[model samples]
Target: APFRMSFAASAKHVRVLENAGLVRRKVHGRSHVIRLNPAPLAAADKWLRYYERFWRERLDTLEALIRAEDKAATRKRSRK
Candidate 1:
């Protein structure tokens, strides 16, 4: 493998994510099967969607302001 992570290190992070309700792990003999629990993910996506819209509108307003400033500058330059 090109990476240098030990199994212990991997398992530690898995435990954190599992505790956060992001993943589910099943132990079958020596094999540990990990899967995503999408409920938490869906909740996060729904929460973030509001901010996404908010920021998009904010950025759009910012862009409009910049464009208006550029137009004003252009008009001033043309008058010179």
Candidate 2:
């Protein structure tokens, strides 16, 4: 399905995307063609993956610490 928007709103959104290096616009007479530039998106994906891995590792360490503490608490309660 084709997307629909007001010309002014569309132009504003296109300008933002163009500035971000995510889209390119080519004008031919009265017509304009917009194309996706994938390089910027690929770079963004790579950066996100790096941080995702970093957070995953930190969360795993936190889970392990919480489990260990819970086990110690259980043992202490049993002995009391």
Best by TM-score: 2
CA lDDT of every candidate: 0.95, 0.97
**Candidate 2 lDDT trough over 10 residues, lowest sum:** 1-10
Q: How does candidate 1 fare on TM-score?
A: 0.75
Give lDDT tens digits, candidate 2, residues 1-80.
Answer: 26687878889999999999999999999999999999999999999999999999999999999999999999999999
Clashing pairs in 1: none
**Model 2: how far residue 39 lies from native, Å:** 0.6
TM-score of each: 0.75, 0.92
* Residue 51 of model 2, lDDT score: 100
Rate residue 65 of model 2 by lDDT.
100
